[model samples]
Target: MADITVKVLEPAVSYDLLTLDELKTILGISTTDTSEDALLEMWIDQYSDVIATMCNRVFAREKVQETWRGDLPPQDCARVFLTHYPVVDADIESVTCNGATITDYEIENRSGKLTLFGSWSEPIVVVYSGGYLLPDEAPAALKTATGILVTGARSEMSRSTISGIKSISHRESRVQFFDESGGSSSGAGAIAAAGDTVNALLYKYMRFYV
Candidate 1:
């Protein structure tokens, strides 16, 4: 038998595997839609219950495809079920955008219920200005860009932020996250472009609570 190639499904990286057109086809939607993000939204709108049933969690891309429903192809059906993931806001004690908009990112799963395994030992905040990044990647960027160089394990100061989060205030939105407390009242801080620029450099904040 000839060996077949199997592409990996890294739901964390949206570019892999399926496109919006693939998802649309699975949901029986028009491919003409300009925005792929919008098409995913449509899937949630029409099949909320079905999607919920598939929210089950798995460790690997192959595992995600393994949970596909009977009606659709493994990739297409799993992609539909794989479109969104729920954030257990309970784990999120307090969030500071640092001027970045707080938006929900959904990951679709076609399995059963999902339990996001992690330790709620402490509350953590992450900052991102460039292209979207994984949770682990965001914290590193936030630390370096905030003039707070930290590495290895938790440091003396980094350990403290977990306790006095709101106490550490921002003067103005440095990283385009106007919704963040650090933004300037004159409102230049509120500008996404300005904030993102400030966010790219350490001139933005004293430290981010990543």
Candidate 2:
């Protein structure tokens, strides 16, 4: 079989993995001032994208349409993996095989595995929703990882007093090291380490097709 192409139909209710209040608590800010809310919101969006990229998955539930081309599965095979995991039955709009609708397929929500009754033609299409249904369903480890990233980013922002440098020459090219096992690092490296942590937690939830 060929690679599957996925497209988002309807986005989730909330894109933020962590609420503003939760982020404030993580940053140890107890004040009621709303001055930094905008900044924090920006960080939340940035960190959310970073986490999603590292994990190769989305945290918020979203409707998606996926297409698979090439040869269909053999008779011996009964199942195929969806593009995303933690699927919901109600969110599965339809399953089509070569422009023909199919109703006998079984969906395994957590694994995002679809078991078809029989072999179908090529160019299979599936429409469904995937990812955590609610913010509470998001893993705590991921939330904590986001907190770590935001903290490092906030610290870096504080240390940088000047913004927008035009043509500053460097004597030597900068070299950076990354520890895939999530070791200690600094600046962007620190954020990468945090991302590694989040990816590890989300690894099991990712969908892998054979």
Candidate 3:
């Protein structure tokens, strides 16, 4: 599994966990106002990438091609794992071993494990789409985490007064926001100081590669 390599055959259409309108709505700003839309858009993209970096995984679903090397005996039909999980089983385009396509296999969607019915000495290649669809299908907790980051970035850049305010409320939605002077103004520092809720939300999504 050390030699297993995963490549994005087709990148996701949108990596942003929070849309511009969502960010505006969270900040209690009018969505029709274009004054700070550019800045907010930049934060959305930047903080989205930062969230992905912190999580060590991409939440947006994308088409990927993975090459897995043999770690078991040639005759042993062992179960192998894929890099990206929650695999779109029906969207699995192809599975080939040593240049030959094989269908004698089973895919475990949630675990991203594949159990080949036949034995093979060569490497296996799997082309499939995996992960959440972003903004649209992204989990609520993840969306909240993204909002926190983007809001923190906004707070740091704005000259508005939010000294003791712990959260910002807009309509029926409320987002947790840290004080700018609380030592986590922006960037990775903000992620580190994101407190228990953000940490807990990101914990399950963190990827550990061995």
Please tell me which predicted candidate would have the highest lDDT against the true structure. Answer: 3
Q: Give the per-residue lDDT of model 2 (tens digit) for 40-92.
A: 98998888777777666777888889888765467555466776677878878
lDDT of each: 0.28, 0.74, 0.78
- What is the Cα-based lDDT of residue 10 in candidate 1? 37
**Using TM-score as the measure, what is the rank order of every candidate, best first?**
3, 2, 1
Model 2 lDDT at residue 1: 55
lDDT of 2 at 168: 44
Which tens-of-lDDT digit does each residue in 1-210 have in candidate 3?
Answer: 347788999888899888888888888999889999888888888888887888787778889998887564336675677767778669789998889897888999876778888656467888999887777877777788888877766655553455557788999999997644446445344434566777788888787755
What TM-score would candidate 2 get against the native? 0.75
Q: Residue by residue across 3-108, what tens digits does model 1's lDDT show?
A: 1122233334421223345445654558886654653544333332221122222111121112222232232111122212222323222222223322332222
Error of 3 at 180 (Å): 8.9
